[model samples]
Each structure stands twice: as C-alpha cells, then as structure tokens.
Target: MLSTLQPLLGLGVILGLAWLASERRRAVSLRLVLAGLALQIGLALLLLKLPFAQAVFLSMTDLVLAVQRATQAGTELVFGFLGGGAAPFETRYPQNSFVLAFQALPLILVMSALSALLFYWRVLPLLVHGFAWLLRRTMGTGGALGLGAAANVFVGMTEAPLLIRPYLAGLSRSALFALMTCGMATVAGTVMVLYAGILSDTVPNAMGHILTASLISAPAALMIAGVLVPEHPDAADRAIVAIPSTSRSSMDAITRGTLDAIPLWLNILAMLIVMVALVSLVNQMLGLLPTVAGEPLTAQRLLGWVMAPVAWLIGIPWSEAQVAGSLMGIKTILNELIAYLELAGTASAELSERSRLIMTYALCGFANLGSLGIMIGGLGAMAPERRDEIVALGLKSILAGTMATLSTGAVVALIL
Candidate 1:
C-alpha cells in the first residue's frame, strides 16, 4: 500500500512546492489544476496502457525509424562511407558519435524543412489550433498564449512565439509564464526525432514516449504556471488567434526552413563539443580531490548525490535512485540531449527497466541552464519591451518547467 501511494505523495509534494512559490495563492484555480492532472493521468493510461492506443502511438517509432532511414540515405550519398550505412569500403557498424553528428543531426534539417512544408500546407496550423482551442476551453488560457504553448509541441521555444507575435505585449503575467514554461518544458519536433534515434533501442516505444511527453507536458506546464503565477483578469481574453506561417510557397517554405536550420544545427554541434569538453575538464579537476568510497569522487557521483532525492521523489526505486538522479542532474546542468546520450550509453543490465522509464519521463524537457539562455535570447528578441520581465522570470520558469516534467513522471509512476 505504501509503495502504491508513493506516486500520490510525489504529486502532492510537487504541487506543495508550486503553491508555496505562487505569487497569489488565492488566485490558483483548483478546478483547472485538477482538470490538468486528470488530463495527464488519462493520457498516460491511453498511450501506455490501452492496447489500441498503445499500438497507434507506438507505431510512431516505426515512422521515426523510417525517417532515420531516409536521413541515412542522404547522409550516405553526401558524406559517403563516413556518414554511416552499408556503403562500400565502410565499417558496417560505425561509431555512434560519428553517426550522431553526421547522420542523426541532419535529421533536424530534414524535419525543419518538413515542418515548414506542413505549415505552408496549413496542416500544422490546423493541428495547433485544435490543441490551442482545447486548452482555451478547458483551462481558460488566452488564445494567444494557448496557441504559443501548443505550438511548442511542434516548434522550438523561440519559433513558437512567432505564432502569437502580435499578442506578446498584451499577455498577462501568468499567460507569459505559461508560454515560457511550455517552451522550456517541451522540445521542438525537429530534435524529438534526433533524441528518439539515440534511445530507440534502450526504451520501448521511444518515439511514442517522446510524443506523449510533449503532449502531456502542455497541460502540466499550464498547471504549474498557473500555480506559480495566477492569471490576471485583464489577461483572460477569449479571442482566438490565427496561426502564422512564414512562407510564400511550398518551395519557399522548404528553402526558408532549411536555411533556418543551418544556425540551429551549427549551434547543436558547437554546444555538444564545448559542453562535453567542459564537463570532461571539470570531472578531471574533480578527480584530483581525495578519494572517497574507495573510488575518486567525480562529477557524476556529485550530481547523483545532489539530485538523488528528486529521482526518488519522481518514483524511481531507491536502489536505482542515484543513477536516475545523476541523469536528472546532468539534464539540469547541461542539457537533455547529453543526459539521454549518457542514458543510451548505460549498460542495459545496470538500470532496471522501470527506472529507465521513469528517467526517460523525467529527462524529457529542455529546462537546463543552457536552454534558459536560449529562451531569454529568443523571447527577448520577439518582445524587446518585456525583456526585463523575461529575464527576471527566466530562472523561475526553468524550475516550473522542471516541475512540470516531474509531474509527468509522477503520473507515469501511478499508472505504469
């Protein structure tokens, strides 16, 4: 019974923290909060439990695998043997690092261009609008904020704001918080494929999990954002906003998206190199410290110690809590991509299947320090007047987003 109740306990603890930190405790809506929690619980059950739903969602993994194959074809043609695949004179099993850089990362470019085409075709906007409409009706979020939040499921944090650019200035504090939290709480669809590729073998229904994470995180973010900063009366507008797509034609959309991805692709490569190198250097320096537990104290162990409770709080088994916590810590300090890579590197026998599932949910967001900088820069550019408010709320939004993901983990624990 105690074990069965842990998830409920975890949910209570997370909500308590949000409530304590709320700007106006009296303004938090219990009805909407319960509604959001119900939505998360229902989604988890449908996507992971029901046979038909599971099959439908899990099929996404095959689709992503198909995308990977397509990406491989392009990479093989351009880079030849070094780009992976069964090309002549190349090793059949290439190094993952090489494949990740040359083969997998290129998928981002493909996905971006594809996303633009979808937008140009009006499919993306229609889908985003449906989700946004649901949020507005259920949660009473303003149209602009709901659209932006829902758009994060498909686009990057920076680019999602473009969907509601005209209303950025007029958004209420709570709505703004929800917008930022949603952005930080979920990643773009472009990178989702990349991360899914890394963990495909390790986690069953990997792409399904990624999709569910983003989908469920939308409400979880709004719930947390509402608690942290309640919506103001002036900010509650029922006017629906149109989804804006920036392209003249299908060809133009593809061209623009490919160009847009250039900087993002480069940034990912640079951050991977720089951050990985820096972490290695830091570990090396820490390795110089006196030995503890008969082995040298390293960054991983330290992070594990720092975040172990969080791992446990999110329903990871105590036996595997530290390892799980270390992943969360890495995600918080660095980024989810690095954390997922480390997870993918872990021997299957070391972390139990349940723990791996919990960690996957926990580490699904883009709430690290690196992302905070990106959010500030991107959102700041869109609304220069509110740059200071954006800066002030940056750190808090990260915490809110983290809580949002953790809440998802807790819900997963309850049902899974």
Candidate 2:
C-alpha cells in the first residue's frame, strides 16, 4: 500500500536531498551513513519498542513530571494565583487557568539547577562518557568530537563545545562542522522539561520522546555532516579528552546554573511576546489580500503550502500535512518553543495521533535562525581564530541540523 511505502520513500528522499547538497558528493561514505542509520533505528526500537526499555523511559518521564510539580511549588509561592495557586473565585473553565510563563516555564530554572548540581557531583560526566565511548567506538569520532556530541544531548549548544575547549583550536574542518551541526540538532536538557510540559496535554510521555529525539539526532547530525563535509582519512584526532569540572562546590554549581538560566529565561519570554504579536500583525495585514478557495490567506497558510510536501514526505497523511507543515515552518523561522506551544494549543486538535508523534520528533531541535545566531556568537567567542570559518559554516549547520531531525522523523515514521 502507498501508506506502507511512504516512510521508505521519505527516507530515500531525505538522504538524496542531502547528497545533492553535499559539498563533496564523491567523498560521501555510504558505510558511515548506514552505520548512523542503523544506530538511530536500533536506539528507537530498543527504547520505544522493547518493554523493559519502555518501562525505564516511562519511569524517567515520571521523574520529569515530578520535577515539574516541584517547580510549581516555587512558582506558587512567588506568583500566587498566576503561578497555579488556588483561584480566589471558581471559573467555569478549569483548563483555561493554566499560565504558561508562570506555571510551566519555571521548570527550566529548576532543571538547570539540578543538571548543574548533578554535573558537579560527577554524575552527568559518567553518563556523558558512556555515550561518548559508544560514539567513538561505533563512529570512529575523535575524543573531542565524541564528547562534545554526547554533551549536546544534555547541555546548550555553546555549553557543549566548552566540554572540548582544549581541542576546539586544533579541530579539523570536518570535525568542527560536525560539532556545530550536532549542537544545532539537539535541544538542551534545561528546556526539554519545559517542552515536555508544553506538550503533556497532547503527547503521552513527552519527556521520554524529547530525550530520545536528542539522543538519536546526535548520530544523525554527525552522519549528515559527514555527507556535507566528508572527513579526510588523516583528519581524525583521537586524543583522549577528559570532562572538565568547572564548579567549585555543590552550592556554587546551583548558584551559577540558576544565574546562567536567567538570560535564557528572559530571552524566551521576550521572543514569545514579540513573535506572537508580530505574527498576529502579519495575519491581520494578510487579511486584506483576496481569499484563496474561500479562505483568507495568512502566514500559516503560506508556510503550510511551502512545507506541506516536506510534511507528507515525512509520512504525515495529506489530510494533516498542511497543519504539520505550518508548525515546522514556525519552528525553523522562529524557535522550537513557539512550535511546541502551537502544537500544545488548539492547532494540535487538527492533527491525527500519528502525525502529532512524527511532528514531535521533527520539531525537537535547535535548528532555527535564532539558534543559528546564538551558535555563531558563542562558538565565535570560543574559537576567535576560526570566527570566519564558523560564520561561513553557520547556515550550513542549520541545513544539516534540520535534515538530521527530518531523518529522525522518517525513521520514526518507518517504525511506527
């Protein structure tokens, strides 16, 4: 049936597009691509299909939900009714009382602090090292690149590179591109909880999927980066890079982590306000244009038209591709936060359960224009000598990251 073949077609089309965009098409290693795909698919099956692994991830999701509840405790004390406290007056609609900024977003700060404390206690380093060991042994990546890739699964783009700071100066061109690409392709742990909170109403076990998406996307990013900029045989640097400890004490780690999260918290708050208002203004302006098929043309319609084919290629049914495409467009143009927020809203009601799951994997990354700027600014500071090179590769990283996530969606579609 066409439905059964759609995932295969989607996977082929995605890889073919990446090949067409390759800077060195002849240098692309088919073996590396297959290995990466195998790893991604294997992980998805182990974690999502196996009963024991499913139970483990489900337990992790419960822990994440517990963290959200814990965060609400702090928000309630600080923001009262606006922060999920008892309402002074009973309202007709109980669900409508949820305030995203005060109730859900605060989870980022709590998770940030906990992650830092765990890192300080050397808990996270062990896990990062375990994952890095797998990457190095399987993918033959250098110590620095492997560690950086693993770290990106749990930290921000700039923060992940800091794990391999000593080697950043000496990295080969291909390794550098791989590092940047992985960063853009993975979401930080700090915001993963927040994203899960946003989609909890729509997606079951959202935290587990967000975590799995980032874990699988790392290899996909490396794979795509290899296609786009194939590594020279002599370019591999296998130096053993150890994870550095930056915190002085547990208390210090929490303080530094909370302080670091403030800027990100403020930035997200500002971006949502400005982006939503601007989108509304744009839609209003577009309302003046002539209707298309008896419907007014708006920004979402335009984006949906442009990206619907891509959505369909990722195995979303045509009946729902337009809405899924619109969410994809919003994620790329704005940020993943906005896209997840939209998915959590009434727009989600229009999508089938399968389409929603595919979109969840697709939109789970930091490949937007805003993140591109952040990566450039952060990576530029760390390796000023490679500033020009980083700037040049910035846009390519976004493309690589986007394709990496799309590849993940394709794989999920095939399995599901």
Candidate 3:
C-alpha cells in the first residue's frame, strides 16, 4: 500500500533535503546518513517488537500516565468548581467557545507548579533514573549524561542540563552534541498541556503519546547526535556524577518554575502571532502562481507537493500524502503548535486510525527553527563560552531533532 511506502518516501525526501541544507551533495556523507537511518530503523524494530522491550515500554507508558493523572489532581483541585475536566464553560454561557480544561493554559500552569513540586520531592528524578539507566546500558551513553538526556523528556530542556550540570563542563564533544540535540528533540513538560489542548478534538490521548514520543526519542537523539560528531574522546573511563538538587522548599520550587515557564507561555503566544501572519503572507504570494487546472494552489500546497513523499514514508495514505507531508514540513520549519492547529482543521472522524496515530507522533517534537533559537538562548545563558558552538550546531540539531521524532513515529507506525 502507498501508506507503507510513505515512510520510505519520507526518509528519502528528508535526507535529500538535509544534504541540500548542507549546501553540497556529498555522496559519502549521504551514505553515512543512510547508514545511520538503517541503524535507527533497526533499533526501532528491536525495541518495539521484543518481548522484554515491550514490557519496559508498557511500564514506562504507565508511569507517564500516572504522572499525568497525579498532575491533573492539582488542576482539578483549583478549577474543578469552575469545571476543570467538566463540561465546557460554554455550557454555562452558551455563547462561549472556550473549554477550560480542554483549552488547557491553566493545566500548563498547574502542571508547571506541580512538576516543580515533583522535582523538589525528587519523584520525577527517580523515574528519570530508571529510564536513564536503560539509555546508559542500551545506547552506550555515559550514565550522568544519559540521566540528563532522559530527564529532559519529563522536564524543561534547560532544566535537564542541571541534572548533569557537574559533568557538562567536562563532557566530550559528542556528549555535548547529544546533550544539545536532546534539548531540541524533546518537548518540555510545560507545553505538553498546551499541545494536548490543541489536539484535544482530533486525538484525546495527545499528552500521553507526546510524553511517550519524548521518551523514545531521547535515546534515538543520543544515537544520531553521536553519529554526526563522535565524542572527541569518549568519556568511557569517567564516572557518572549526579548533580545536586537545588530547591529550598516546595514553594520556592513552584515560584522558580513559574518564572521559568513565563517565557515558554509568552513564546507560544508570540509564535502563534508571527507564524500565522507569515503563513498567510506565503499563501498570498503563492496564490499569484499560474493555475494547473482552474484553481490556484497556495505555497503551503506547494510545500505539500515538495514534501508529500515524506508524509507517505511516515505511513500517511497516498490520498493524504500531499497534505500530510506539508503538515510535517510545516511543523519542522514553523513549530509543532502551528502544525497542531493546522492538524485540528485536517483531522476528522473520516481520517484512518493508522493515519491518526502517525499524525500524533509526527507532531510531537521541539524540532522547529524557533526551538533551535531557544536552545541557543538557554544553553548560551548557562555557558556563554558555548554560544558559538550552539549557534553553529543549530540547524543540524533541527535535522537531528526531526529524525529523532520521526524515529519515534516510525516505531509507532510499525505497531499500528
């Protein structure tokens, strides 16, 4: 079926684009990337179908859901009277379109506070420890670095670095590359609620799967980041050192987390404004193009045409490949948030279940250009010396990040 071919199609298009991004089509580098993808595909199959791996996957999925459920308790406590998970406020006002829990800004706020509390209580780090242990053993990463990389799935990108803060200054180039790529590849805890809100109508389990994608991609990111630039000198002999926890109290933790989350909230709002405007501008320009039949297609559609092969490779049915590939391309170039809004319009009861799951995983990542900047800003603030290096690696990180998310989608696609 064409749906099956989409994955191969997507891989070819994306890799071709990546090589073009490098501004030269080097055959050797292309071969290396092809080899890397082969390794990624192999690892994905082994992890997904293996009995022991599936057992671990199940336990991890349960743990993520349990955290989500516990986190929801806080949102309910404060807003239940206002219908946190109850019917939309529209039921009360009749004219209001907003559904508080499903709209989800408040949940982001509540989860941010509670995520901090969880960190203060060390509840999450223990969970991170178990998952990171798997990464260290299976993927050949140093334990301390692996811990930070894995922890990013449940925490903020910048915050994760603090877990391995002691080892960062000393991390080999590859570990540092893996570290930076992981930041760009995984979505943070704060936005998980926001995205769940965005995709609520189409797929209800967006949060859980987003969480799962982040976890699965963490090690995938390590593998790819390591491949691109092998650790200068592998930190093989170095022992993994844990960073000391730094919250004075739960209240203090909540306060600091809220402060950290403000930019995230603002960025989401700002990105929505600029990206929507730019998309409209692009669409308008493309509308001037000569028509093929009787209708003029927009630039987004042009992108859909250019990138359609990728959508197919990721398991999108041939019928939807043009549209689906465009959406995936939009998510990578723009942000997942915009792609989700676009997906909301695209998703309907009519979409196939397999297509639906692929969409969910495809939209799960921090691979957009804006995130590359966020990595620069966040990591730059921590180590001013690494700003140039961060900036230099920015584009490659987006590619690695996209590959990481696709790698997750590939696994989920196989399962479907």
lDDT of each: 0.77, 0.79, 0.63
Each prediction's RMSD to truth: 4.5, 5.1, 6.4
Question: What is candidate 2's TM-score against the reference?
Answer: 0.74
My TM-score estimates for the predictions, one after another, are 0.75, 0.74, 0.64
User: Which candidate number maximizes TM-score?
Assistant: 1
lDDT of 2 by residue, 1-416 (tens): 66668877887887898889888899887877888899889988887777587556556556655766788899999999899899888788985897877975676577667767877887665655565567656776666788788778876786677555546787888889999999889987767878998999899989888888888898899999988888886676633445565889999989877776666556556645655577678879999999999999877668668888888998899889888888988888778988999998967899988889889999989987667766776677567799899989988998899888988888888888
Over 4 Å off in model 3, which ranges?
1-134, 236-303, 347-351
Q: Measure candidate 2: CA RMSD.
A: 5.1
Worst 10 residues of 2 by lDDT: 236-245
Off by over 4 Å in 1: 51-133, 238-301
Give per-residue CA lDDT, model 1, range 1-416, as digits (tens): 65457778889999999999999999898877998898888888887766587566446545655766787888889887666656565455554436556865677577667777877887765655565567667886766777778667766676677556546777777888899999888877657777888899899878778878887888899899999999875666633445567688999989987787676566656645665577678878989999988988767668668878877877877888778887887887778998999888873456888777777887888887767766776567557799899889998998999999989988888877
Off by over 4 Å in 2: 54-136, 238-303
Clashes of each: 0, 0, 7
Q: Which model, 1 or 3, shows the larger lDDT? A: 1
